[model samples]
Target: MCCLRRKKNKQGQYQELISVVPSVPGHSAPVIPVSQGFCARHGEIPFSLPPRCVPQNTAVLRDAERQEKEKEGAMKVDAQRDILAHRGSLSVGSWYPVGSVLTGLYSMTPLSEVVAPPLGMATRLCFSVEYRHSSEQLVVSLLRLSNLLPRFHSNMTLVELRLLPDDRRPRQAKARGTGPDPEFNDCLIFQVSAVCVLRSTLSVCVLSVEKDGKRHAVGRVLFPLEGELGQAGRVLWRDLDPEEETQCSELGDVQISLSYSSSLQRLSLVVLGARGLQLLTDAGVCVQVSLQIHTQMVKTKRSCVVEGEQDPIFNYRMTFKLRPQHLDDACLRFELQHPNDNRSEPPALLGVLVLGPFMYARGLQLQHWMDMINKAQEPVRMWHRLGRAI
Candidate 1:
């Protein structure tokens, strides 16, 4: 059964967390019968514990009594096998499916010739902005909005102005939010340094802000400031588009331990168990965990599959030598497949989890990760969520 815990957030809002526990002894809990198989689309099953088997006695007994005992033993074994089959069906077709910390303004692009306006340069550019129609995918659209909010669609949006070369922090200017094809008669201004007028370029970014105050850039345009900011200021019109959507799915989770060696510059990962798998196979599944470092070239390490078990206990340890400087470019990817040699069919991908050290270091699990890094020699065990390939 699942346990629910509740707590109040800083804003006095209540939130819930769920955890599961084993069945209680001697209690008759509601259970889904093994006869009824699992549903592929909806993985719902009544929770129940399988019955224990009775052992046979060595002492002599009446023929009728012995025969009856043997029959009961067979029945117990069959019941256990039925439960395993049900669990396999559930594993083959179950899915309990269901932010950003910004560091300093860094390089958005990698062209060396580009330079940002010097700090403390005082200059202001005024803009009359509007958001026209956007054909971008819904998911990507939420990411590229002028408002800093995440939503199905945004009505309130604004533009943030930045002077390129990226050494200086960029400032934001907001536009009034409107519905689709929203028009903003409101004017916004950005004050930048004088150097921004010389060799630096102007980057106008469209942002979308939610009621909760989260925002992201929808699209941006780069304008060369060579001589555009002369005596008379100029008004320009621009349009932006969000990038394509990256594919993601709620597959399951894998429990693993991580440790790093500062002196040897090596990282060791211990695969523990992958739970909540939803692979469709009669012979069970295998998991493949790999790590890749992308510096100038890509380096990779792959682990052998944990055969015969859907939710396998690998206890496999893999290590890689990685420099602290190259940590940002590293990625860990996990996959689940059927252990087959038929060669005729490719392995099915049950689910996957891909993590980039740099980006994920700031997540809620940051403390656990930091501890692993700081203690270098100590390994921290954690459960990481799995997702579909992009």
Candidate 2:
């Protein structure tokens, strides 16, 4: 009888194989015949590369596919490059005289990201200067505010912008409404310099913000903001015909006045939100702020004091300084906080609220300042060399 040999399995089950006895000393090897069980586990063996993962042929296919993908990517890049080339290089970082900046650089809104509707909304801007400069310079480009144009798509407008030392004219541009920010649809240059102070102002006439007029958290011309910020708004308290929260533009010269009344006081501004007034203290630090809520009837006779949560309009005035890095560029941030409202709203007005680098309030003219920087105390090197040659 033929000997049916079996192979041992870990599970104690036997796998069959053919056993052959040879006459030669070492020819007793068993050969398995071609049968159903012989090739049962076709794909069970483990291998390094993936199945059909051919290195040479698959690599060639992969490389070709990769090349095709790269070519497609190149087309997209080329299209963008062509678009950029069509639009000449933009001048952005050049420093220029404070006076040369557009009158109203729109302080546009980041309304786009939070709500999608207010994204690219145009914002107003204004800067107040109270000093002068010894030397200053001006830098400008044709496309300063191009990034914020998608929403309004309006060519830059110098809406009610202001600059320093105007003829001291009776023009109500300075104290009245303000200009827009650079991010607004307008590309207006709002810079000024003078004997007393240089202030820059910017404004955007229209913006594409989401929300109906009167109750709109920031209204139509909403400026975007971040973190905690302070905002001041004119409120009609005690006697109300249209009592609900109304925007500054809706109030239309309703007499809103903010001042640092206390002598040597750190009166930081706080936005009176729905829950309560949030004091914008120094960034990243918890500061104990002392506040005094009073009435400034400068713009109106309906004077009402500010308190805490119970009253939104008559809330105590709070003030704190944000670290330089966290200081917002807006004069007035959101006055109220709606849970859904991200603090990305810019101030209603644009331009530097705090007198900055070249303003007279801070120092002096930008051009003279640049002169001081680029000017040489000694003779020019080229002139000195010529003199030595002589």
Candidate 3:
């Protein structure tokens, strides 16, 4: 039987070959069959044998098949690249058929995980409360007290959410108060500053409007944020208390009066005195008053320092020539400070009084001057309460 044999040529490399046959008389060449083996990296594989005459058609056919497979693979890789490029443009919340197929390739990290903790903390703290009203009547039938509202009715009620310690503006959610079993399903969002999460309180106030168009506080609930940060989907019910009210701790009081003259176009601030000052230092206390017109400091006045007295009496008057229309953008600031003999120490802040939009009206003019003062000489004087500085 004929069998393939291994042999080597002058280069001294192993080569597999069919046994040599006798020379043919008509062909004039030795009849030898050559079999080719492929090398992956190099195009052609070299064998340790002398070149023998063979048909080229078989080699050409094998090359054609290899090129066809390479073209098909290149097309598939390009298609995959385009699909990934398009997938990157889609938002996280969006879904597509292609996205479903490529789910394993995309990151599964949530949006909160990639962002800051404060933003995630705010989102986790926000929740919805269901309010079930017990009364459906337009007006309370049992409210017969003279001090109560004339015709108290609640068409709509809103809940105010105040996240404390940072003192950001409160957030509110409203619902229709129509039926006896009306469910508010109101979503309240509160952004808690990260610095105060450990020591903050969440106060919610429920307010309803009366027939006289005045909104009155009906109930309030306060929640302390001890360790309730990670609880996102938990629902808690807080019964509203009609007698509850959100009140700030009393700091101190200052006496002041405001007057505006139309003819002179001047706004006068009369600082009569400050009583019951809650200063921390034993040093004498002095009051510093600054008037800002459109957030620009226009005038500043300091009171005479009282020696060893908490309640400093300084009849200091500061006036500014301001346009009547500027009342919309003007604010009066009063800061209490201790007069320090040591130049190295900064002035200690006792408390501050800020008369903002609630105290003054934007439409303050000669015609609207009646609302400010009942009579010309009698400037409206009141004991202004001091709170934390803005």
Candidate 4:
């Protein structure tokens, strides 16, 4: 019998060959007849091989089939490259099958079609100012405030006027109506010099009073008293800028009248009233006044307690003995306190105010001090804003 085996040729290629061997030892094997058929792709077969060797032509056929597959694969790759090259220019409709409905369509709405929440109303104040050259006094007449938005069910609104850089003493008018529009035919007069009329600005603040006596600054306007506006008296309407939440959280105002008598070597402070104070508890509130000289507590006094009144009227007076030489280092501290039921426990502090020289105070506090020193023996009354406790 004979078997077919594969061997490598000198050209490094594998070829199929038939190996002849005897079935019995030392005996010649019988030879079979070779096939005379010829392959259509690989040509004719050798005549020396047996008929069983005819299957060897399958290896050649596999090689020819593999070549044809490689050619077809190369053609397919080139076609895909051409499609990808022009992909950007192709329309979306061409990518999908014809008559197929497109799903999940996305569209954006125009800005004009979008609805937003309506804003609050704009507040306007109508007023006029006239500076008299002969009297050196600037007179401001507040006619009315229109379009005032009510924060609470019952709103009481007031107007505060201040002359900047020259005078910081706040002149407040009585609060008016609970409606959106309130009329205030109030007039405020401030003594000014020629330079003050040209350089100073008039600040008008509109405040809303709540039932709890908490005051919120709704809006404010700063009008420059320069050029034609300060020279000629004309009625003008100005829009008020809305106050921020930080400004509204300020601890109210305290009306204090100060007078320093050099002859008596004494300083008298009258706490007439306080408005817009914030009360956190049902306990009564009192004002604790302390006199500090060179950071040392010299004397301390407390006002009478008022129950259930956030805007309390104390009308209390306290006197401090002070020398003229120590006036520069003297400071007065005021604290709003809630008295505790137990006398042993300390009172709860709400707000504080300090009035001293330029090094210790600024704004209205410093201005108050300078005014007291400038107009000695004369009572200088002003409304001072309170701040949070230390």
Candidate 5:
């Protein structure tokens, strides 16, 4: 879930940013694409997760899994994709294989591109980006592995979600939420829910929106967990004006941009915002407390230094090498700092993790991932529930 709250500017356009790092985190673990299961259409794609087998002991479960893999018996599963058209006479749609992310690794599909629709096809706007994991066997291998053991069969329900606006309505917000109201407003917030099934041995890397766009800086809002809300993961966003630039001014100047990724529901931020003058302290984000999750693990870097207060948005970044070692399933969580509370200051939530990392089948890769997971101590909790079905 992503939470974004900031004052609107004179031009009705504020700054936004999103960044990507090397080591992957949360359920968005970067995994190799190896399989291709079935072809997908643009409306609603159906898929399923592999079943669970409760082994009495750890050794017993491992042994049974080994034997089942050796037998070569297979489970046939399917997932479909939907093709969507935004404008003009264009052939645009999302592609999917016949299987889940774990099972799909066998067909050798090379992921080489980001996701976007083509240009010229859409009227005044166009975005055709595709992030490819593998070039070959994108879905075929997922078929083979699904047959061998308990795996995940995912049904991807695709939505042609866009940060669209209507001209008939005023695009700007009222003065400090007091003046005349604007007609058309999509402030990038909505009720949402998600379910992930990861009860298997295969792993996949999460391709994030910030990484795909190669964006430099971003605003990260951590959502709160409240049961009555019903929907928690759905999000909406608007593009910032292209004219504004952060020139290291004294009045606070940072270009804020954002990205959305289907794989990782939480918005991953790119750290590179403007550094204000040292005299002015880093302006803390006036946030609404709503962060929720079961903390399986979390690692981040935060240091305070300001070049000037002219820019309130100060950027900091930390890299976390993650791997899920033990799992009932994996979930990501963002927690608020207690000390920041009180002092007329609302606690800021950096992130809320919905999913965690999964590793590959190869021995070397698995070993490396296992090492990373072992470092994170358990007994952590954020808002959990997304991993139950995955």
Candidate 6:
């Protein structure tokens, strides 16, 4: 039989109510029932279930990777096309994209061939001139050079002074500066005779020296000494004339007579004389003439040495045996040489002259050669200008 029971709270009020079943003497506890056939075949089921395995699709991933590679290849091809289009147009300081890398940063323009224009500048010279009666010497002072044009490469410059007709000795002074205007506070002195002082003129030339030891005349100016400035020196400025227009007095001039004999197969060349030869010292100077066929020198002759003379006379003659056929390829080279004081050093070359056919000659030199050929046995005499060694 069942019975109801009531409990009291701490506040003296009825709290919980319960129903209880009365137990009989010697009774057991209650148990839950289960199916015996299912329990024997399988284990008991778990409260939660495990997740299932699923297969993945790889084709979609491969397609996406191929598309990415194609995009990269297209970008590379476009970069190469742009580089080819610009090519040499890219300046050294500018930057541009090369393939996938950024090279320089500037505009991309098509490259084209360009030619550099010839550069030239008007030059001026500042100098002072004076003649000392007591010393019987002419003095030239080079102050400075202005408006000099910069060369494509670095070079050395010097000023050369010569007292014309009477004194042809070259006196040079080196200039020093880092800019277009150079300073040359240097003096040059030349001995002058009383009779020739009034008639003498000062020839000034500016020469540029290269690394190969070759000298080129840049410009020149001529100053006469007839005025009162010869007694009391005066500073003056003069405009330099172009090398082509101005006559180079330092190189001097040579007179020669050429004749050929067809029957004897002989060529006769006479070394008459040379005047206005510019020398660095009072040493003896001689003229050496050589006959060259093609590249080999066949014969050579030299004139007598003359000392202390601006104009030297040499009546020496030379003859070369050659056939008419060889004339087309024959060339004559004349060199002016002076002995050096020091035995250790070689002889110095003053000037040179080359005469031959059109291939080896020009201007007066060519004209002289043609006249010798046209006139045959008749002697053709002409004056030729001397120049630095080729």
Task: Give per-candidate clash totals.
Answer: 25, 71, 0, 0, 116, 3
In model 2, state the lDDT of residue 277: 27
When superposed on Cα atoms, how far off is each prediction in RMSD?
36.8, 27.8, 19.7, 27.2, 38.8, 26.1
Per-residue lDDT of model 2, residues 39-132, tens digit only: 6354654335446655656668888999999999989877765655564444344322122334257665453232222234333222211221
TM-score of 4: 0.41
Model 4, poorest ten-residue lDDT window? 110-119
| CA lDDT, candidate 1, residue 316 | 76
lDDT of 5 at 196: 11
Clashing pairs in 6: 95-104, 95-105, 96-104
Model 1 bad stretches (over 4 Å): 1-250, 295-297, 360-369
lDDT of each: 0.52, 0.27, 0.54, 0.74, 0.26, 0.72
TM-score of each: 0.34, 0.18, 0.34, 0.41, 0.20, 0.37
Query: What does the lDDT come to for candidate 5?
Result: 0.26
Put down candidate 4 lDDT per residue, 246-280, tens digits, no spaces: 24336787878899998999999999987778888
Residue 238, model 6, lDDT: 80
Q: Write the per-residue lDDT of candidate 5 for residues 274-327, one digit (tens) a residue.
A: 333222123343211121124433444443433334333434433233222223
RMSD of 2: 27.8
lDDT of 1 by residue, 1-67 (tens): 3455778889988765753544445657545434335333335634656897554853534676889
The alpha-carbon deviation from the true structure for residue 20 of candidate 4, after best TM-score superposition, in angstroms, is 99
